[model samples]
Target chain A: MWLRSHRPAAALMKKSEGTRRDFLRACIAGAAVLGTGGSMELLEAAEQSSALVKSRVVIARDPMLRGAGTTVDSKRALNLLDHAMQALFDADHPADPWKNLVRPGDRVGLKVNALGGHAFSSNLQLVEAVCERLQEAGVKANDIVVWDRDTEELERAGFHISSAPNHVQCFGTDRTGYEEDLVTYGSVGSRLSKILTRSCNVLINMPLLKDHDGAGVSMALKNMYGVIHNPNKYHPNGCNPYIADVNMLPDIRTKMRLTICDATTAMYEGGPAYKPQYSWKNNALMVSRDPVALDYVGWQAIERKRAEKKLKTLEAEKRAPLYIATAADAQHRLGTNDPRRIAVIEAQAGR
Target chain B: MAREMISLADVKFPDVSPINEIARGAELGPRLLPLDRRSFLKCAVMAGAVCGISAFAEPCAALLPWAGGPTQGDSQFTAEARFYEKLQNKKIKCKLCPRECVVGDRERGYCGVRENRGGTYYTLVHSRVCAAHIDPIEKKPLFHYLPGTLAFSLATAGCNVNCKFCQNWDISQVRPEQIRADYAPPKTVAELAKQNRCPTIAYTYSEPVIFSEYLMDTADAGHEAGVRSVVVSNGYMQTESLKAAYGKMDAVKIDLKAFSESYYRDVVGGELKPVLDSLVTLRKLGKWTEIVYLVVPTLNDSDSEFRGLVRWIKTNLGVDVPVHFTQFHPQYLLKNLPLTPVPTLERAKAMADAEGLHYVYIGNVPGHPAQNTYCPKCRHLLVERVGLTTGQILIRKGSCPFCKQPIPGIWHA
Candidate 1:
């Protein structure tokens, strides 16, 4: 219904010739001044550029966790995380642009989203496995900091409180004015936590896959809200452009090396939380360097879950994955909603 | 012709919450304090107007117009936030808004600030400023506070909302790191505003709610230096944090997007109750509160809605609260729509007047007669205005010169 209302009734405008070059030029120029220009303008351009990069979402079907029975074993989660990471990044360094940025001794900041408790948050086992792999790949454990917005939530999700000196320092930005001095958000001055913006050589975006009440789906880009202190202010007119725009910020996106979304127990509706009745435990993990594409596939999975339950469609709920289109059409980094350019692969767990 | 509904079989998986009895509030770990919506409004309205938080509003105000410029100095932007819980595999949940974002190992929040990294959530825009500006206090449209004075404005990237017709979409609609940012610390912002002779620092442009921490610190500094503060914001806020900050500023301007709940849900993605609650709270706190209602053609400019809004303001906030119905320009995602017609703005002003709002004015249309402030009882122009610059005030000690009806505002001798 939302798409019906918003889908430009007029035929889509043809991509103007040289538009891609113009966008790329703008992006390069925008990136050049990332240190000086206002963060919001950089975000706007990047977001618009990301939206222009049209990509397809692919969900690997044929359940992998179908046979794994009953037991609440933590090891299974680790296996899945390891499987997903290896499948996505492989033994080889990420291709092209990312290949040059990621390396050993890089203080890799593992950006995680724990808005959902145990049911819907990133699996600790997966996080540990991935960190271990990073260490194996030459990144130091002490250099890796697993963080979010609140220490309490971290504890609630069974995260070990890491205040020990020299260990992977784990702390929340919620501690008195932690994000208070950070940059502003648009004309709206938004403060972000210093940990995400000020301290980290490389960032690894890790978000859970879930249906969001406001945005159609919450993915890697949306996970950045934990970087800032006040998110309620941005929840306007469905948080469409702002959420998409905020995700494009250079401080958040530029420092990031990859996006990896967790879809093991995908929440289809009424989520960001685990709804057992409405949840679909596909027990699969998804990883990608492209945040937009990662979320795109997750959105499709959510739509499928809703359909099976006879629940309201994203459109019926007055919400849809409009940001994906926005991210694709943004700076024209991605094509015009075409899946051909997006590489979708399926890999099984290997010994 | 109507189309037939599709079968459910072809549909895909939906994002649904667990119905298990265990999947209640504890799973999300509610950090949001229990405060009534109205109380939250009060906090939003009073933010930065009080002493300690006065510094927070200054940097926000100064950063608005200068978003595209060079970083002033001494601010490095790189780091991540803390606070989140990791689940199985690589999924994480953000504990920031009421919407606890349960993200996989690699994801972000609905606000686009927090992110999931290896099963942990981290903030990404720390100290990254996207926009900055210095303008007259009247530009913030905070008429009731320091009239004719100037303010320093600032903002970063990212908002919680996705208003299709956002004027500042270039900035307010993106993440902090996506944009270029300047390094203007609270002290630098305060010094700059002070150097520019701005008595009050204002946190305007975009939504100040998203940058609470930045605004808070800026407000603190401004107060220490004897500079007053103000905030122009959409009053959607969580009460606990807002109250803690409200005790630090001098004035506030709340953008009442619309009066109807449906309008808020569809067009603003916010609840009307929160805004109304803020206005009432501002009134009770004795803070200088003004409201801006941007009149979008055919969207929020309905006479009935304006009338209802006026009635509510009169009954709840009293007739003293200044209400401005500004004209809207077609931009951003809503360019297909036409600019708000001048007549629509006139009608809105009339509706407010008819509903007994004493200080209703039309904005964004310079040189209009309604632009000047008229005494509620005497009908005398108390303070004149031409765009953002203010003219002579005919009132002495907050009273009209012609009829002596006292005007309510922070007027100087």
Candidate 2:
């Protein structure tokens, strides 16, 4: 079941047309396979919803998300995010997804990919929209911490560091350092970031959809490298088993609630960094509960773009993102890479 | 032999540092920068790059206070790795060591110092020297080579092998960017050696094998200015790279680690065969070589292993190769293990002596009797050394004055 095609509209109407209870039941089933254990309590807004989708990836898109050059329409980007969240749980309100996922007392960690700097990193507006929605869902503003690998990197990616008690906190693992103890899974043995271990219990994976020279695609599962201390060591062998193994860590597997992949600008080749000549603006945000599925979709999108440009496929180039399949493999079972098991819910928030 | 330097406008430096800058800036070039020439030296001192010379050049180094040093990493101070095969679609296979790491674009090899970028291989730690010192040739434990003279020692970060009991693991096991490194190019290294009154430039601290390009270029620069080059290494290199790199060396000291393959597998994340092959190749190339075996307690300090090591040395590399059975203190991942007893080192030396080895020494334990170099025929002490200090040199014209037997070493500078 490794086909992540665009069957979200049809599958959403067919699979999510049932009661809200079916959504939780399917999520729990998905969780059992992926080793994700959490309380999936229904929210007030989602409780009255007659329809809900299981493993639904709400893809929010808008041409107005990016203006001229690297500047983005932050307000329009937020609207697109809100629309995606509203569509995710098949609920009327934008706050429904966040309310259903997180508790009021939970410390939510927004792990954003600031590796691409200002050019192709996770947009501040999308991160802000997420923080506001979490606050609306009753999680404390102070409890929501946005972080990456380092403070400089976060700043370079256009995020301001804030540790003010009354505001939504933001910083890096460099501020607190990594855990002293090494967490070992498969061939991966590394110290996890204190931001992931000590500062927050709940994690929201906010990554970018970009072409990776080593891993084929940098998306959901690949973004978890930010939580560990030695991401460099795991890059060999196309980061296959390493990426899958890292996600199996207790905190990452169980605590992570959602993945929001910002695909507003992406690279078809020569990436993991912003190669402006090879980059294209797609202006889309992919929101999903399944990290593996989201990454699979991102890979296909990159592959499609590469094909359009008449470049070699990642497999032909010998840099295929096999980590997606490895994650869904029997040993990992983090999420489904199979499109057959995933339903896409497209939210076209046009200007 | 004036070492030249450049300004910021001459090199490419990025805002995000360490990992990203190296990777992203790879296309711009192979991150190569020399040590501060006259123009860049003033600014380098102002930037707080530690004056590498703790010797005669310390005043010139200035030893300025660091402004956190490098804003995290040197923007472009490296060289193109000499030994690597560019694979298809921007991948590369590092031909430097036995671990022919097939690296994808923007990723590094197992050494973490060499990177591949769009089908080009680059050594990120070329002139990026993180550790530097002025040491006696005896400190490098090359007792046979310019015994009383100083060797300008330097190293960049990263090692091909992970030895559990590595003494210099701090610099040896880290990426170049994790530590602070001064941009000292080949010619600059030669000038520093000569300025510090060091006759030899010793590539040491971290594995010099990982920084083969730097060593080779520095060796050339040193030779051009009449300064010699030596290397202290794990000898875990491919024969071609080893010959191509170490061929420029006036002397070499190799850490043989352990004799058995299992010890290499369990304790060192490398193989014993490649290191052994490197030693053979070094010998064939007629390089002045010394072997140091750090005896770790309960790991590689078995009587059988010692007997096997000396016996193998006698069989292959010959007993004439100076063997030093150094006592090891608990270090790195092997900190839980007790120190190697002095008697254990004595026992290993005794075994090497019985195996018909010409010169065997005990190390790390200062003031030991075996620290003195004795004539094999007459048993008269030729060179007396106490740690990094040379006490007496009784070898005249590369021969023991007492026995009149030719002692195998570069006795005169």
lDDT per residue, candidate 2, B217-321, as tens digits?
999999999999999888999999998999999999998999999988768878999989998998899999999898888888888999999999999988789
True contacts preserved, each candidate? 0.04, 0.16
| Candidate 1 structure quality by residue, lDDT tens digits, A1-351 | 011111111212222245776546444434433444564465445545544433323333335443466322355555555455444433333222223335677787787777666666776766776676676667666777888887777777767868575667666665423442335333233556677766686888888888776677887767886776556555544566666566665576567666667666677876555556657677667766666677666777788778888888898888886767766663422222345445566655423
**TM-score between model 1 and native:** 0.51
Quality class of the docking in candidate 2, CAPRI style: incorrect
Per-model TM-score of chain B: 0.76, 0.84
- Estimate the TM-score for candidate 2: 0.69
Interface RMSD of every predicted model, in angstroms: 9.4, 3.5
On residues A1-351, what C-alpha lDDT tens digit does candidate 2 reach at each position?
Answer: 111112222333457766776666444444433434442222212322423323567788888776664666778877888888777766687776666778799999999998777877888888988888899899999999999987888999899899998898899887887765556677566678898898888899999888887788888898998898667667766887889999988888777878888887878887776778788988889988788888888888899999999999999999999898999886876777768667777789965
DockQ of 2: 0.18
Clashes of each: 212, 11
Considering the two chains of model 1, state its CAPRI-style docking category: incorrect
List TM-scores for all candidates, in order.
Answer: 0.51, 0.69
